[model samples]
Target: MFQRGPGVPTVEVGALSADAYLLDVREHDEWEAGHAPAAVHLPLSELIARLDEVPADREVHVICKVGGRSAQAVQFLNAQGRDTVNVAGGMLAWAAAGLPMQAAPGTEPFVA
Candidate 1:
């Protein structure tokens, strides 16, 4: 189980939806390697500046290489009044769960 931070929530990586408002917060290199097939690529470095792009009404699932960055993002976004959850175990767990992923064009798929 994940440590809950104040208002932040968490969901198992296997339970995520491809159609939900999934946010990938990994770095560019990590993203370039591969990511959730339907996730929106909004690196954490750009999250604050691009906060407007995140839907305030929807429950957002934030993910990174591991749960750390997404957990931090969940904390921040929750403070901003956006309903967010950390994708527990992140990409590694997602891949382990046999979830679909997409890599950069011409590259082999692998979780970064």
Candidate 2:
């Protein structure tokens, strides 16, 4: 059986708490295009190498362009005993909710 951690809880954008740590697992280009305002860019490719950067005490909301990569990431993190949850529907859902997206510092607004 897959055991879930105590802190991690998957939630929709509308249900996400402002205080939660949102981990964006999309690629650099995709993240630069647009992402949740509260999200931290940690592209899936580098996640394992940077696992130590994630705080173990806080809940981590993992997200991708859709939900595939995030789901995969959540599984991996869970197996590694890290607290993580997949943000269902991902940035697409967040955008559909009319949530605000922050551009990279000093960069132009994301076109996509």
Candidate 3:
């Protein structure tokens, strides 16, 4: 599939390292529903206030339910001088690629 936003740096699921720093920009429920096991939770809606939580020493890999919000986050983060990349197709592709995920206890892992 084509990249989601103009000038948005991107990486596909296949190229992602299991140890890569991942940022999930979806809402809490969506994150609880399922997300990359190593991902950091920071909703796009709360991003500005919680910007400090983002790690400054590493390249941030961002994702959303789809590519939209994460693309926006990448743009914002890059503008703020954080090296970041959008996960092309976001969680949809993440799940399709069989990437590891974590969810609430006793619940199935899935993209919400």
Candidate 4:
């Protein structure tokens, strides 16, 4: 399994603003259902091919529906020398925390 460095900081939804980059690793449909405001969608399936989309200078927070995929993403990005953090508990936790979500245009909602 992948692991982050000791004492890596994680931002809660309430504390997140526009300072860092939010990378959503969920599938297309899941992302369309709901996601953090200003989050950039880069489905796990396409991450490897689209790494250039992420800016290296800023903090990147990886998120998925729960947490698994985001963990994987963090591992991959870290291996590539990119600074990334996994959003523990993922979007589910974000919703539980009552964070705001926006519908991604042109995408269909996921039933599950």
Q: Pick the candidate with the highest lDDT.
A: 3
Q: Which candidate is the best by TM-score?
A: 3
Question: How many steric overlaps are in each model, in order?
Answer: 0, 0, 0, 0
Per-residue CA lDDT of model 2 for 4-73, tens digit only, reads 3444456787888878899998898888877777778898888889988777887789999877778878
Put the candidates in TM-score order, highest first: 3, 1, 2, 4
TM-score per candidate: 0.90, 0.83, 0.93, 0.80
lDDT of residue 31 for candidate 4: 79
Q: How accurate is candidate 4 locally (lDDT)?
A: 0.78
Residue by residue across 1-112, what tens digits does model 1's lDDT show? 2233655588998777667789999999999899988889988888889889888989999999888989988888887899999998999998888888889999988877
Per-prediction CA RMSD (Å): 3.4, 4.4, 3.5, 3.4
Local distance difference test, each candidate: 0.86, 0.79, 0.90, 0.78
For candidate 3, the 10 contiguous residues with the lowest summed lDDT are 1-10
List where candidate 2 sits over 4 angstroms from the true fold: 1-9, 105-112
User: Model 1, residue 87: displacement in angstroms?
Assistant: 0.4
Candidates 2 and 4 compared by lDDT, better number: 2
